[model samples]
Target: MKLATLRRWFSPQTTMQGKIFFAFGLITFLSIVSVTGIVYVNMRDTIKHNAVTSVSDSIRQADESLNIMLEEIDRLNTVVVTSKNTVIDTIMSPNEEISYEWFQEQKRITEFLSVLINYKPYISRVAVVGLNGKVFFTGGPWMDRTVLGTPMLNYMLQNGSRHAYFKPEGAADAITVGREIRYNRETVGIVMVDLDYEFIKKTYGVKPTADSLLYVLDEQNGYVYQSESAPSSFAPSLEKVVEIKRKLAGQGDVMEQKINGRSYIVVSRLSEYTGWSTLALIPLDSLLSESTRIRNLMAEVAIIVFIIILIGSHQVSSRTTLNIRRLRSMMMQVKDGNLSFPKTEIKTKDEIGQLYRVFVSMVDELKRLMEGIRNSEKKKREAELTALQAQIRPHFLYNSLNTIKYLAKLNGVPNIEEVSGSLIELMRGLLGNSNEFLTLQEELDYVFSYVSIVKYKYMEPIQVHTQIEDESLLGCKVLKLMLQPLVENAIMHGIGPSENGGQVLIRVYAEDQDVLIEVIDNGKGMEQEQMDALLGSLDREDAASRFSSMGIRNAHERIVRMFGEPYGLSLHSEPGLYTKVEIRFPKIHHAETSAQEVV
Candidate 1:
């Protein structure tokens, strides 16, 4: 008997309380565990993904900015080198000796180049180097022809490409951009410009930190811009640079590398403009610092939620089962022939409380019958007693059980939905050729039909009222399918989730030459920031935020596009009180759209 009682207390099939408690507890626990697990993984992955994306975007922006600067310098070279009589006349005539008149021509050419170099602040020095003799330039105090007789300048000059190549590892500390000057189909000399290397680093936009370093290298594995704060081992040797390039060609823009036994995330972008590769390196742990914090926070949250759910679900289950136990004890008392009904009120609206009320009625009817039998004489009333037993005893017991069984089964069934003809009308109205401008009255009719269908979802249906200031305003023409989305949002997001169904006011009036319409709901409102993002077209919000407000945004944009600025949709919300969305457009009526009124 003890074993049977234990089984009844725990087994879901044996008692209603056991079944309710087990199902609710299992479902709540599993839901909490599953949601916690998904959020835990997704948060970490999202942080990592965003970090990678940010690095990639910064690299591309750097590339674009560098390209613009390089192109301007190239154009500067073409303009000055190909000038009608200044640089071309001076550099092309290497045949002439270096005399007083030659110095005069060089001075005139230098003065002209100086006036142009001021336009580009990144240009350090601009010079025209002759193959045989002089170097004329205009800039700050610097070497005139330092690389004039060097083999590095000769190799770049022989390439025969009009595009300039930057030599970062040139003899001087300055990075040089040199292009061969061809005249009359023959190479005369080279036009070279020493660029501000520090300016290039300043413009790259990625700041170096203790945990990160950004540097640049030329094609020969020579330093273009090396970080002063970088570790000595961070600068790879020539062979290592070549190996890194090879692996990156096969891998991607970013890769993982080990330097001095420490892991780092290495990102490299080779600029076509300068023929230089910019590399950014951050320690692997540093890259995930934000994500690590997020992980720890999530872990703490998961523990707290688990504890709360454990305690809360247990309390709810125990409280429900306690009520069932009380009713079950009352059933046992009646079975022992004590047919007095309790005077307790059935205040709870749950299944157990309903059973308590039914049990009380059954005991009361049985007690009345027993009292009636006691007032009769026994021996003389034998046939009557037998007839009464035949009519009442077995049938009454069967009928009482049937009533109790019906009450138990009824609690499991959901409320039946009445799908009225409004749904069919709504479907028909949404069909072909309804996308043109709609009259105000025609639009109001659609709103009414839509609300009629939405009303079926609530026990106490939402109240909708239309307030038109002027009767003739119904003839105004507006964009089709405009107000419906606003109304739908007011119902679904504003009022649908509310415990007590809310009231929606669709107000239309004229302000100046424009028709002003507003859909206002007396339901749960939102914070100002959330409402701002819903109405504003910004990419910073996540996919779900954008999706929930897509329809409303589309309508708002269309209204603004048609009517120009000072128009479109605006939302005013007071959290937990109300939300109001307004639309403003010109009050124009079209004769052709009058036929759409019947729709």
Candidate 2:
């Protein structure tokens, strides 16, 4: 019975919290273990691979350094050989006497040697040995009489081959270069060079770390020089060195080797002048320490990932549920036609914050749509009101013209027939049912007809002038009756009180893609305030009733509606001087047939 109780207590179904915690703990443990295993395996392989690569790189750098030193030495040898040949040629010249002052000749020889030595300090000694076996200008200390009987002269006389000979054995080592000096088709002397061993030592400086080694080897694949830190007897087998040299002769620059139970990376490069090889070795262990550090870092990262997964799941679930509830409430309020919904202010700028921003944008667009609908309905009612007012204006004008005709007949005027004809023409234009847009030519013609009637009625006191350039522009379309109201405004307010009646000038021309018409009157003009009241009416709701210039205001509205605000009527005036009304409209092309068909 006790055992059964213990089993039940440990069961996952004991409590909901216990079940959830158990599952989370099991998942977290498994995830950590799996990640750690995978990371450890990959880290081990990567460290091995990286160690090999680093050793290879170190070997290559060492090889390059050694190769550069060898080339420099060869270059110095060439200079010495060339200078010696030139000296021999001078001595063997047919016109030159063998009895030439020995002091002057020796001075010239010493100067050449000084210049060569200054430039290439690696040359410890430079000497010219005559065919008689006598040394001249020798720079190194003489050992004894044997120095004059050195085998270098005999070697140059018998074999025409150059020698890069090394000393048999010494702590202070040296390399000897011997060459026969030829002049005018005959052998004159021998040039001998002894290069200091320290030159090679300084040229190939110590490697940066213990993992790397550098050394110089001869053509026979024997070690002639090595770094101070290298083993004293650290020579690889001749067979192995030969293989390395062959592989590197005209082939790859790097290779691998195992020397004395330690793995090494090796690189070789050939010397251009002497055909000698330079070899470098690098150990593997030192190069892989960096990879060990990386593996430790990976282990730490796996632990951190496991901890984050455990904590993050619960926080994400709780926050998501709360934000979803808030969003639902916001959407319900918006569906209830409450456009002024309160904005959400969650400080956490996560995915939920982005969603809230999008919701705000949608609400703003919806409000703009509702406002547009209301404005559209208001415009429909206003248009109906305008049409009603339009119908009433003609009736009032007809009754007034009839009264004027009866008054003329009662006065027994002899021009009653002409007055009646003008009235009928005026009424016809005012009451005409034409399209809202008319050609510039037609509108101008209407204005001209009205001017003629005004001239007849007002007598010879009033004068008018009209000037239009590029009559071809007359086909361009404009709002109907744009000019008539402007002309009437000038006549009533501009010239009504003038003692000597004013003159009106109407000019029309094309400027770029717009038509410009200017109407100017030399009469009593308005003040700035009056002009502002006239133009400002377009933006005002009750502007039509506030201003007495309804005709000008109506023309302004029609032009703006047709071609946009950029092309509209503008008025400029100075009190008691002049009043100018300018109208601009987009250029419209009318077919030739249409222009001719319009009366």
Rate residue 88 of model 2 by lDDT.
62
Tens digit of lDDT per residue, candidate 2, span 1-599? 98874465358555433344445657887978887778777875565455445545554554565455445545654665567434663444343224566445656766776666566666677666655433455466442235554454455456544544443333456666666676656766666666677866776554544646776676555666666776645545556666766766666866566776776666665666455666777665555556668777877887888677657744654576578678889989999989897867665688877888788888988889889989989998999999999889888877777777788778877466445656666666658645766677777767766775676656445666778898887877767778887887677667856777788898998888778999999878877766676687565554433233456677777777766768788888888899888888777775333322322
Please write out the lDDT profile of model 1 over residues 484-537, one tens digit for every residue. Answer: 877887887788888987999999999888889989998888887787667665
Quantify all predictions' global Cα lDDT against the true fold: 0.71, 0.66
Best by TM-score: 1
lDDT of predicted model 2: 0.66
Q: Estimated TM-score per prediction?
A: 0.44, 0.42
Backbone clash numbers for all candidates listed:
0, 0
Clashing pairs in 1: none
Question: Which consecutive 10 residues in model 2 have the weakest lDDT in total?
Answer: 590-599
